[model samples]
Target: MSLDPDFAILLRASADRLFFLLEKFASARVLVIGDLTLDEFLTGQVERISREAPVLILRHETTKQVPGGGANAIYNFAQLGAKVLAVGLLGKDEQGKALRSLLEAAGINTDGVFVDSSRPTVTKTRISGHSRQSVTQQIVRLDRKSDDLPDLDLQVQISQYIKEQINSVDAVVCSDYGDGTLTQPVISAALSASRTIVDAQKHLERYRRGTLFTPNLPEAEFAVGYAITDEPTLTQAGQDLLALTQAQHILITRGEQGMSMFNREGSAFHIPAFNRTKVFDVTGAGDTVVAALTLGLTVGASAWEAAVLGNLAASIVVRRFGTTTTTPEEMRVALQRLLEEG
Candidate 1:
């Protein structure tokens, strides 16, 4: 239920080293390839009930756009001082324009982003309403995307870009959201690079052996075809996931219970949740984990140590709404506080 006391001490004592590793992010290049989405949050006030329908009218207030999916992971990586190269598809539309501007403002390299005329930039809009004294809550959501895959030319361009960029980056992160960007060719090209990590919604087996797979508890259960209600079952689930995916390492993120790790050789480690504080929002927490964990591995941290850093990163991002990111300085402070409190 808690982190080992000695392990906590070690984590604390290595604070400087951890920060040093974070600094290395500036030099280590990571390629993020997959679904690039624009997340729009519209916050308004509940005005009155509609005359013709049961819905309540909302007084328009403000709208904000941020990165989502693979874009969010790239944002997290950039926030942590990593040199991130983003490779994905975006439509030649306003949403795509805004998303690219946001990424560029965050210092993420977007030259690899393919602009396909056939698809609209994937956009998820969340409408939140609040009374004068009540907290805002999401009332509805709308998604805009293209159902078809990228045209042949666009697909070929994406694959060629991956091949060209693969040899240069320190690590490759496949942030698949079942979007067309992460096609089989893209995955194959990315896996050809060194130290590839995949965070997918489903079909874990697509990524071949030696890849690192990060799937949350429910995702793992779905992939492994069972319930993971206890430690033993969780252990077995991790084992099953590794064998099913043919991955060298598997990390199962368990929200409050923390994260569980497994490798091909049968070694497993469970990292307890870093914070005892209330979770404000869990949107994009998985992206934070994938970002921090892959960054850790890029810097040569052990599987368990990387998971610990990821656990800490997730604890920070969940305290905010919409897609958010954790910074290196924030992580250092949180880890230090976790040590002192422990």
Candidate 2:
């Protein structure tokens, strides 16, 4: 996409402000409250066809695991140098244990992470195929999760935890992936206590009166019960969401097309996606956006500035693999490169 000169100029000045905000992330405190998940990736080389079926056989090369879902939001904040505390439910299983260890080792506060044995840790196992000629690609995915919400007792426990810790954080991030951790009680606790930046896959209305809503195009469409096939429709969708959620800001994240944000009064701001040619994976890009935006808002950035920072952060993370994150130094490099190219 060609940069509009006016927007390019704005990007230059805004990038400078974002550079300053990046410096304050080390001290910014955020509480991530939502579903906790483990993302597993099994990559292999397709060697030969299977005899039993018309399927290719894979020579399994490596298996990798990482924090996903709401855990990914916590990981993003930690990677960006924020003091992030996680509040969610995990399963009493090996995946949960490994995810907890990863969070603790990364210096994230996992005091609010609870465990239950009734269900397994919300997990997604992606199998990727590689060949001498083809690019690495996910061939199939396996998901292990239940649609049930957390139990009443567990909900109360999580709500109580949020109430206690909300006052300590600069902002709260509710990353709901419909994995039973974000119950009405828990969502209410976070929304009632602090400024919440939400990234939910569905049921966006449950997160009403949020400080900000960052739903991708399809999620927004789901919430509004319509198709957004053009700019006018997209704008209407933003306005509809703003009314439905009563949020101060609404940011509809359009992959490759960038982001479109609307305010309480229905004023809109659109940002183009960056570094499109370098996108390698988009698994955890939303978490990356919410982490950067929450930190930017905590450090006194305007909504547009926060969204730009998110756009930059998303740009960086998508160039990597799986549920990953980007650092301040990387943000700086990206910004500098953007400015130079502009």
Candidate 3:
């Protein structure tokens, strides 16, 4: 597809703005709230089929673990030089402790992370073969978390911490993974505190005042209560979500088709995904996108500019094999290439 002439100009403008924004990221502070998870990857070789069943027999291999979901988003922000504070519920377990250690090692402030003794830490394990193909998957995904609002005592503590820190931060990012942590009350408290960016795991109408909504196609459809089969429908859906969420900006991630952004002003822009040979895994791409968007806005980039930066950041991560965070340097290179091509 040919680039829109106007979009070309916009892209050029965004590229210029990115240079300044990149510097701002070093000094920006962000608050992250939502589900926290442990992503475990077991890498091995599938030697042959099992005689007992039509299944591949995999040999034992190396194990790798990373903080994921909302925690991962916070990690991405911190890695990009942002002072990050993360608030989420974790079970009192070994995995939870490990996740906490990982965050601290990465320089994320975990003062807001609370322990839910009623639940176990959520963990997703993927077994991949030598060829980097996922051979099996298992989730010890624990949601023993209560849907009930956070403990009154804990909520009071969290609210106090947020009040003290909110004004000092540039942005707040809600990385909901359909986990019970991000309740209506939690969102309300966040909105009352700072400029909020949300990456919803599901359609949440109550979160309308969010500064930005980043939902993939399916999530977008769910948010608007319709199937997005074409551009018109997609545009309408974006508008519906923007209105419902009271958000000024909506970004619908279209996978292979790239992404489209709709602003409160009734203007929409689409940017195609960077051409790539293959997609290995798309685990943390959304987190990276939200991180980039929030960071972009903190540095004074307009909504459109932030969305474009998000697209560029996601393009690089999708081609990787597992949950990974994109660095600012990587984003800078991608933006430079896009501009040089113009």
Candidate 4:
């Protein structure tokens, strides 16, 4: 797709302001409340094709683990220089322990992370096989989670934790992956707090009267119950979300097409995708957007500017493989490069 000429200029003009906001990230405190997860990757060499089956035999290699879901959003905020507090549910298993360790290692406060013995940790393990001459790619993924609702006592504990920290942070992020932590009580407490940004997979409408809603194209379509194929349809989807959820603003993320933002008062605009040349993997790109947008609001950015920062952050993460994060320095460099391009 060809670059939008006016969009490039707008980004160039925002460079100075974006830099200032990034510098303010260090002083911003954000509380992320939702489902926590551990993402595991197992790497091996593709030795040969199986004689009896179509599967390829592999040589065992290494296993790596990182934070995912709400944990990943916290990672993104921390890497961008924000002081982060995370609240979520963790199982009393090894995966939960590893996830807590990863969060603590990043200097994030996990006081709000609760442990429940009845459920298994939400863990996604991906196995990658490769030959000597090429980089490994994920062949398959295995997920471990609890199908049952968490104990009522556990949900109450999570709700109380959010109420305690919501007042202390500059902003709150509800990163729901349809896990049990984001129940009605928790969502109510979150919306009561100031400057709440939500990125939820389920119960999108249940969250009402919030600062912003960041949903990817498909997520928005699901909430609105229709296909958003073009500009007019996309605009209607955004408006419908705003009316349904009553959020102050709605930002629909459209992968390579970039994003569109609509406020409750009928103001709307679109941002073209940035750094489109080298998108290797889109894993956790939405997390990057949520992190950047939340931090932008925390630092007093307008919704439009926050969405722009989100676009830059998403652009950076998509160029990387696997689940990862982007730093403030990286964002500055990206903005500067775009400015130079013009």
Prediction 1 global C-alpha lDDT? 0.87
- Per-residue alpha-carbon lDDT of candidate 1 for residues 1-342, written as tens digits (9 for 90 to 100): 245797777777777777677666566789999799999999899989999999989989999999998889889889988999999999999999999999999988998998998899999999999999999999999999988999878878888998998888999999999878888888888889868899998988888763799998889989988899998999889888888888889999988888888999999987777764567788999999988888888888778778878888999988887789988888888777777776
Per-residue lDDT tens digits for candidate 4, residues 131-230, read 9999888899999998788888877888888888888999989999986778888888888887889999756888888788999998998999999999
Which candidate would rank higher by lDDT, 2 or 3? Answer: 2
Q: Write the residue-wise lDDT of candidate 3 on 1-342 in tens digits.
A: 235577667778666667778767887889998689888777667788899998777788788889888888988888778899998888888889989999999988998999877767777767666536654554223333344555666656666666677887888888888767776667777787558988887856768788888999889888778899998899899889878988888899888788999989899988877644455677888898889888988888877677777777887888777778877888788777777765
lDDT of every model, 2 decimals: 0.87, 0.89, 0.79, 0.89
True-vs-predicted CA distance for residue 122, candidate 1, Å: 0.8
Report the lDDT of model 1 for residue 316: 93
lDDT, residue 247, model 2: 95
Worst 10 residues of 2 by lDDT: 1-10
Every model's TM-score: 0.95, 0.94, 0.88, 0.95
lDDT of 4: 0.89
